[model samples]
Target chain A: MQKSRDYAEWYSRYIDDELSAEEKQAFLKYLDENPQEKAIVQRLQSLQQNLAQLPPTDTSEGFETVLRTRIQIEKKIGYGAIHTFFQRWRMPFLGFATALVVFLVFSGLKGIRWDGMPTDETAVNHASMQNSLSLPASNINYTLDQFIASPSYSTDAASIHYQPAEDETMNKNQGVVVDSTGKIKQETTKTIPENLQLSY
Target chain B: MEGREEQSKGKKPSDEELIARFQQGDIYAFDLIVKRYKQQLLNFVFRFLNNRELAEDVVQETFLRVYRKRHAYKQVAKFSTWIYTIAGNLSRTELRRRKRRKLFSLSDIGMEEKDYEIASDEFNPEKYTNTVMHEKIIQREINKLSSKFREVILLRDVQGLAYEEIAEIVNVPLGTVKSRVNRARLRLQEQLKKSL
Candidate 1:
């Protein structure tokens, strides 16, 4: 019975002439042993041929004229230009858009950690990390690499100690002396301002 | 001869070439495309919807889409497959709309009824009855087929499209198309056996 069913598939192939010449011979030999199967193949062939011959209907009248008119209207309004563009590109666009939305949703969820009051341990960790890091608004998205490399980063608990410098000491004891006493410099002692001059 | 030159020029531009021309905005090429596939699409849609009027509407819409979306067509597939896909989709949509209205245009209304009415009036009425009844039986069996089987059979047998093309048109794997076609042919025979 299983064998007969396998041969049944060949019936369509035989009818469609898809079988190789050798398979055609094999199918014929098999059919000769099976009259009922042979009859069925003959009938299927008849049916298919009848269907093939079934009159192909032509466009009623002025199908082109009507379609042309509709096309002219379509051109005028140019509707479905966007619709057709979307229709043609529907799948790829949908796929990209879906990926984008999903990514944004997930990323947005991840980004929202700093926005709301911390409710969960992860959010709390993020909040503490943000405050402890004192991340500047400009560098809000400071990454791990940046964190490690930042000047504020220290193994010891060293907080920032910013201090203003004095302007007086910032200026140099302006000139170079060859020795403590023998100052055959560029004869610039007269040119030196009192505060900037080196004391002999 | 000028006619020969026109024929050579005509060398029958392939459907691809015609559409290529149409894509280049040759209105004449567009006219040729409409003329070429119009009837074939009509018959396919007509069989699919089993409604002459609606089938024409669907075919018209199919062409309108081809015209509007001419630039969207790529050479990756045959133009016939592309157009048939359009017609087939419209036909299926119309089929769903038809089901909503609970209207099946089988023998209760169809081409067979109108075919004999026109042919018999012009020719022998007696002969027309027998032939028409036979065709009516076949058509009814065709209508009895599930939409899945019906579409495949129509594409494979009636329209004489390649299995690959049918597969593309129906968006099924080639193996599935082969089996569906085989089973559909058998089912059609089994049904026609009883009635015919």
Candidate 2:
């Protein structure tokens, strides 16, 4: 049964002329010895031939037209709608891009701010800090002069004002120290208890 | 309507080129793709279900999916393989729906289209020489196989795809495709002998 089953598989390949030369010779020899199975091979070949000759099934006469119409409906209903959307908007996008580049070039040549627009940074001091600071969580780092221009003093004259935490309390678990001004103060471990592992 | 299926030079763009163009928003590329594949896919799906209308619908759905998911196709795989996979999946799903529908479908209450079968002439054993009758019997036998055997058999014997290509289309190991196809052929041969 197993030998015949192998021969049956080989018959399929044989019909297709797929068996290698040596295998083909062997398959033919086996078929000669087994006349009954040769009929089976003839049957498979006839079926294949009939299927092959089974008139190339032409689709319905309007097949292409129908498909095209369906695709057109799809085009309107968001099939490739993204592609269509970009196509419809392409010229506008190019126009917008050009306008942006022109605006950028003009702005670059002039001061970054058009004369009426105030581009100057806002000045914040202790008063602003008290209003906005979450002291324990804040860590702002900027000099007042960096933001506000000093009329009498040079901008270099100002130093970074390190804001201390309100009431100088440090949140130990968070290991963060802040001030009423949102600027962060550097924390120093001023007192280290003598531990065996450490050198003074 | 201006479908460019083949180049004037008789050297058409590769499937990859067409799909790439489709991806780049060239609707005509999709037209070419449709013209190229519709008949073959219809034949495949039609043979799968043994129903012309449903097969055409499945092929359309397959193309629609291809249109929607053009970006999903990568250059790494053959476009035919990718599209065939879609058609095959849709065909299988339709087959299952048909089987389930057969059980409960009543002509009066069917929300779906009424079952229109290929009217195979009453099994006349002596009429085996009639080619039309033979074709009908063969198609019926194909549809009656389990979906796996039916699928591999169609791809191999009817479509004549290489075992390697069939493997990739069906997403199976090459040996599995060969095994299933051989089994299908053996069964088909037996049934056809009896029928004819």
Error of 2 at B184 (Å): 1.0
The recovered share of true contacts, given per candidate in order, is: 0.80, 0.35
| DockQ leader | 1
Which digits, one per residue and each the tens of the lDDT, describe model 2 over residues A1-200? 23786777787689878899999988988888888888778767777776665544567888768877887787787757677799899999999999999988776555445545422222133323332232322333323232233312122323333333334443334332334444434441222112212111
- The CA lDDT at B190 in model 1 is 89
Which docking category, incorrect, acceptable, medium or high, applies to candidate 1? acceptable
Over the true interface, candidate 1 deviates by an RMSD, in Å, of 3.3
Over 4 Å off, model 1? A1-3, A81-200, B1-10, B103-133
Per-model TM values vs. the true structure: 0.62, 0.61
Worst 10 residues of 2 chain A by lDDT: A191-200
Candidates' C-alpha lDDT: 0.72, 0.70
